[model samples]
Target: MSKTIESIFKPHLKPKEVYQGGKNPPTSNGKKIYKLSSNENPLGQSPKATEALLKAAKHIDVYPDQTDIRLREALVKDFDGQLNANQFICGNSGSEIIDMLLRAFVNEGDEVIYSNPCFLPYAVFSRWYGAKQVDVPLLNTTYDLDLEGILNAVTDKTKIIFLTSPNNPTGTYIPKSVLDDFFTRIPKDIVIVFDEVYRHFADAEDYISGLPYVTEGHNVVAVNSFSKTYGLAGQRIGYCYTTQTIANYVRQIHKPFLLPITSIEAAIGALNDTDFIAETVKTVQVGRKYLTAEFDKLGIKYWPTQGNFFIIDPPLPEFEFTDMLMEQGIMVRPVSQFGAPGKVRITIGTQEANEALVKALKK
Candidate 1:
């Protein structure tokens, strides 16, 4: 007998909530529209990256290097050779690499653990892969990850743990000492995926990246992207650092030439543009401080952030507050779907944009 469409697919497959990224606000009174919703680099892409991208455009007829040798080599130099090229796996974006990691490690009925309010992809992909998800809520008072709760949630069926530093929306980060203790307690067999796309913005002295754990040969993967820091969101390029064993496994599943040659060249050029990186970081840090001070004066409550954005407990409902901002020709994120209802996430923008946001809030 012929099979029906539903019969061909796995029974466990079910629809999940799609990610709702920041959107452009409606035009208002011919005023300048400042999109502070997406946490994008307001200064734009680096000059060096644009130059390299244009140069690589001439070779559009040829496929990119399947091995990603040149790009990986650039990464090696960027990290001062602490991680070998073979340990890196380039992807269309850090998001894609994360999906690949889930595909590589998770199987039907296996459990995946993560904080309740996290980068949505973790829950979405876990469900897609037929893995049971364990949602550990963040600490109520501080909106910080409940590491002790996560450790207690673990079981033999657990396959992976997703950790996001300077966590999205809330923007809280796990301190080095906290993470060190957490690492010692976690089972070495379970793969830990650390998303640190915002590490460059986390200037706190106690914050740390998962690179050290990776170097220690623990079952850890550090995922990073050029999107946030290098203004390469349009390029859709990112990479991960992990043990050679896991890298090989993920590479085996990844199709060849998944990244465009131009994107690869752009990332390499961005890595070389250290001056631009420093400038972007400084701009974000300054803007963050300015916004924080303004919020304090206004008696607004918000979590202390280590990323380019922070979640605010606004006077009105989250959507209401966001709509109010939109009417003023400003765009910001309403993160109820990320599990923080009645709160909004605002990205730190340029000095002009920051001033405009403050002006709107004061009115």
Candidate 2:
């Protein structure tokens, strides 16, 4: 006789798939766990950021800058007037900013276009709002963005196009020339959500982040995170820069005082620590090359990467490969959940961790 919970829910709401984060490496029998799953900065956070957080702890009772104005101004200064404070909106993480983009623009039955095996939040959140996901499959051989396929898939119903540099799992990106071609062909009215959270580690000669498009006043919203580059994943700070029009819409939904005081201060500190950032990028570059060379020596097939992580097309099934890696006290990401079977993504970690990963794969 009890009233059912489903009866009161909105008719459009369906059971959405939960996002799977990287697992914690288990410590069993005194084995050291090397976590290479989440693509986190294995080097850890900046000392300057740590100092800033500790200093800010004295003012725990105080609220954060309601406008997040300080971080916005820093970003403006960081980018050197290519953008202004009014064009940015800081969020808890890049994921939240992506979600906000959907909230501000996508309506029911709208179509969101993105490559398959991409950052899952785009699909997950689009469905949360009853939007249809139009996934363009990756080219089988290269595992890169199928720009031709993407163009063929677009329709008038499309509201947003999600693009990532050094894309998730595969770590493949659309080359600048390809992006330019696509932009010229695609409708300018459709919003492009360009996620470049891993930009700092990407050293490819032809790579270009979305900021240039934003400066040209294209309908592009570029999202970057302090998580990976600044090693502030724990702090959960990120920002999105876009046209003034898009920023105004996001501001309507993104309330003030959303970010905390400690996180804000740490992010500011992380931004100013240019020496730490340069060193981190250099280390990641070295590690990336080391892992790639090791993979080649092992005769393992991997996608060339611009990001700190690379994808391996392992001989064994992905789940089995992951289990084997776990037994060796190293954790790597399996891409079955990301829609690629028999493939795994490995984060390029410290020299020691990278060496250990290759050793485990050899067995």
Candidate 3:
């Protein structure tokens, strides 16, 4: 009998689909391509961060602090007592912390709850651990979490609940009132993981991060990434805030020396560069409005957004519309994989890039 690699792997691994990130714009036509596919900062990395990274290169020979103490302290200081350094679990990225949370809390036969058409990683992590997934459908049209539905779905088997503010692809968020109610009703034993990766972009009056709940000593953890506001996606640095108990458990499962020295230095610099953060947020806010106005003029249907990207229900199929845009040297994300059919996500780029995207959509 011939032995196969698949035979040695876990049975569930065979059916697991790989995630497809946004593609790099095609340069075959030699046209100037404006990449608004990935939700990246159009202004690029913080200049202060860049300088810090370059300076930190001199110490490449040494290992990074295994615990990321300085970054954790900075986070606590930023939050003004909402969290403490001991309540943190710094990781290579927010996604990494998500994975760690699942590994630490979820077990085979346990159920994990999340909204459909949300961040894909939540479902992926649950599946990887052989856990049952309970996906509640979003409220129709608005794409907000069906809080009542999620509450009803809870069972004794449910171990974790994942919520995202300014949720990926759709850009909608859970209001503070809803969160307050949900926290009150949910089981205290069940862990709540709030993915607030785009928290910086959210300006809605009702939006709330998981930090306050964490402050109140709820079983909640809020994940944040430097990738968005700091323009440090390439650095792959992020952190989470939870109770000291949960934080200690997560740190046990996390790899040692997880963050590179340069990444840590860059993130610290990014945190300190208030001017760069202000400009980046302003640019995204302006671009978001510009895109919305332009889409309105073109009679395109788009979801209202609180993040750096928004979804558009195009006249044609999403992939078809994306291809049409690509022909004009523009790139945007198709959301079919995210379970939002007939929709595409357009990242808020610079004024020039946003205008070009609008012009292409018009064509």
Candidate 4:
């Protein structure tokens, strides 16, 4: 009764592609590195979060609480202290939560809806979990969510719908009205997840956070990360808010102790760092305006984005543009993998980095 290991492996198993991200060019080689990529917090982490990390570092030998009690309490307070532990689930990364959501609800032949040219990171998870990822095309370079098109794509097999307001790379958002209507039309049985990793950066009047629906008994989950705004990308701590029942289901399928002890402590520290959050918002808004102005002056076409990153179609092809930027010791994401062969995504960095990018583009 000896079965070969290859036969036992899931037949649907497909080799995954290696994810390419922005690189922090080392300071050597006498080249000045200006990294306006990877949508990271250019200013760095909050002092409070940094202090908390240092303090927590002393307990390196001990295992962290698997329940992530402290981080949950911090999330409660951050959400006005109205919700409790059951409403939340922390993960090693927002990417991990994406994997958990698909694994918990999606099945073979079940459909999952998402925007094309979005956080391609999710594609790896959705495909690996056996859910057929139904990609909806973006309207323009920004990929303003095509609500009507997505609605038409849904069917009985659709198990999950994802909305990344102020969507990745493109930085375009679905209006609140469109979102409300989608919520009304979609069957409540289907799980909806609002990936709001850049929520703090979005101040557009049309942009709306999906937390209110979570409180309204809608089968919705709000997934976010401490990486971008809180500067915890390396720590990889993210949390999800949803109904208790879904949280319980996620727990059953979720890998145990997913949030390492240090990550939990770092997230708790990040929550209390309100000043750092405020500073990050102010910096991005200021830099965003500046970036848009540069685009306007150069007559470059771009979408108005409420999030920290946005897509732009320069006069040249992105592959060549990206290579040029890399040679200059600057990193920007080219959108070929996200389905846009000609456009590139740029993240707002510090003032200095932004200015350098502007000059680089001008040349």
Candidate 5:
């Protein structure tokens, strides 16, 4: 008799539900469809990045630099040499870098802590690695991270703490004062993984990036991505900056040539196109302001956002509200899966897309 598939794999590896993002909406009667579901850049990729991608396509047969030296150099220059080139590690996406860190640090039955309704990958990956998940609930109504609750949840078993500033779905961020205090309280042996994929879009005066903690000799790993800010989502390039010790450990487990040559070139090109980055930030800011004003006029309540997206508590059921938007040829994400049932997350898109959304709501 053939062996069962489950029997062949590790017994601890039970069937797990994977996280799903927004789906592409179908065209309705030739109506224009705007996808505000996945938080993608509405203005599209930079021309310089496109040019670099096309140029690198000519050398598809060649392997990428295993060391990722050029991309690291560009990042160092991008930050004005605030970080060293040797401290960076490139991956397929920010998600991949998080997974790599998990693999490098977490052992079976070790506890991992994070806020609920956060980036679900934290929970999914923790379970995959046999780590105990300690999810501290966010503060009610405000949807802010409960720093005290998180600190109280810690124990000797805790291995890593995942923090997403300007967090996904809710878009609320940890202020500098809160983070500074929280960092002081956290145990030194426990690793802190700061997912800052949305860092570029944040404009709040109190907001702070995690890079400073890494530079200050804390056990912090700050993950970033070219996907959102650079409009190179399709290229799938992400990276992290940390101390040499942690960076070395993550690099040891990484496979060579994981990044494509085109992706590397595209990221470098995106870095060089400073004007494009500025434009994307401005577009998101303008679109966000317009939507918030419309929401106010319509008496719609939404969480104030620092990221490019915001959460809304609709009068109708979350899924039902999403379906209504779908009928209007607009696709926004229902974020019940993020543990915030009855709320929907909408991406701030281009001027046309924002107007389309407001028009649909006005009907």
Candidate 6:
């Protein structure tokens, strides 16, 4: 509207892209869509967390704890039996954690190296901050990390490198030995961010989470979410553990009263409820196994998954296969967006939802 407003803008946002969220199913009175697109917990939010939210409803007039002291303390009790509170800064979502980290470290024109066909929002966010986003290909059909390619992608401008274990869409993870090797060659100054929202699903002994690296004094930010494991995505809660120095830097850039009061209470309740955590993991484990067996029986080619979602290279074009599924009121993500052009990423939902997809495929 004004020249001052126009002059303040940059070309990076000339055409801002919409973040592609998970599909919301239809209504006639809202028919439930078997939502397998986003790697959401098919089990729904934890009952204890829900109970806490309902109990906390009367406190809406009060502001949320700005520092999330209670939630941070809870995180310390859980993740910190090994690490500590000083290692973490809690946020509204895993995405918000990224925003805080970027604000804390990235300067204008710095280089950020992330895997191509990796997390889509990251590319958008990096460019928005005026940092260049470099995308490298997955080494094979599965989106496993290529340590050499990643090291080669790094440059003098590189500030951060993002690695997702049990990576989304394709569902492959880097083994500990490989990640150790990858970290060895990177410049000591460059920070590495590990997004492990789906780490709980991994059963492989070698499929390590990033906590070990953090313990060794590496410049790493390891953030796992309560949303996926505790089914609290609606509450938008996630936390990151970094070096105490990085945590201090991140705290300054974080928005005040960020995590809602009720959300924090819910997350605390979720943290305490170990029975629910065990049950959710078991249910997903059962569902994931059933889905894999069904895919194999159907003779459908699918990537071996260690996360909540897996990619299947369908017999048709990616969009065409997706359209067929959507018409049946089942929504799955097209893997083309993540660089697997002919595949679809299917979240392992309930036994029924997974079976429904298999039935749809049979047609």
TM-score of each: 0.97, 0.96, 0.96, 0.95, 0.97, 0.95
lDDT (CA) per prediction: 0.90, 0.88, 0.88, 0.83, 0.90, 0.82
Better of 1 and 3 by TM-score: 1
**Candidate 3 or 6, higher TM-score?**
3
Report the alpha-carbon TM-score of model 5 versus the true structure: 0.97
Q: Could you give candidate 5's per-residue lDDT for residues 1-363 as a string of tens digits?
A: 888777777545687778886687775678898999888887899989999999999999978887688999999999899989989999998988989999999988899998878888899888888899999989979988899899999999999999888899899998999999998899989999998989988999999999889899899999999989899988889999998888887789888878899999999999999999999999999988899899999999899999999899997888889999988888999888888888999999999999999999988
Candidate 1 segments whose C-alpha is farther than 4 A from its true place: 1-3, 25-30
Q: How well does candidate 4 score on lDDT at residue 175?
A: 86
- Could you tell me how far off, in angstroms, the CA of residue 227 lies in candidate 2 after the best superposition? 1.1
lDDT of 4 by residue, 134-196 (tens): 988878634778888888999999998888877887888878898889889988689998899
Candidate 6 structure quality by residue, lDDT tens digits, 1-363? 447765768867777664677766656256556888887888888889999999888899988787777888898898746777777788888888887777677878898888866677677778778888787777875567878888888898999888888887678888999988877877998989998889988998899998888888888999778878899888888989887777777777777888888888999999988888888788888988898888888888988888888888888888888889887768988866665677788888888888888888888
For 270-292, candidate 3 gives per-residue lDDT tens digits of 98899999999999999888988
| Reference-based TM-score, model 3 | 0.96
lDDT of 3: 0.88
> Cα lDDT for residue 83, model 2?
87
Candidate 1, residues 131-217, lDDT tens digits: the string is 999999888789778988999999999999999998987899989998999888999789999999999999899999988988888
Best-to-worst TM-score order: 5, 1, 2, 3, 6, 4
Q: Score candidate 4 by TM-score against the native.
A: 0.95
lDDT score, candidate 1, position 184? 89
Error of 5 at 119 (Å): 0.9
> Candidate 4 overall Cα lDDT vs. reference?
0.83
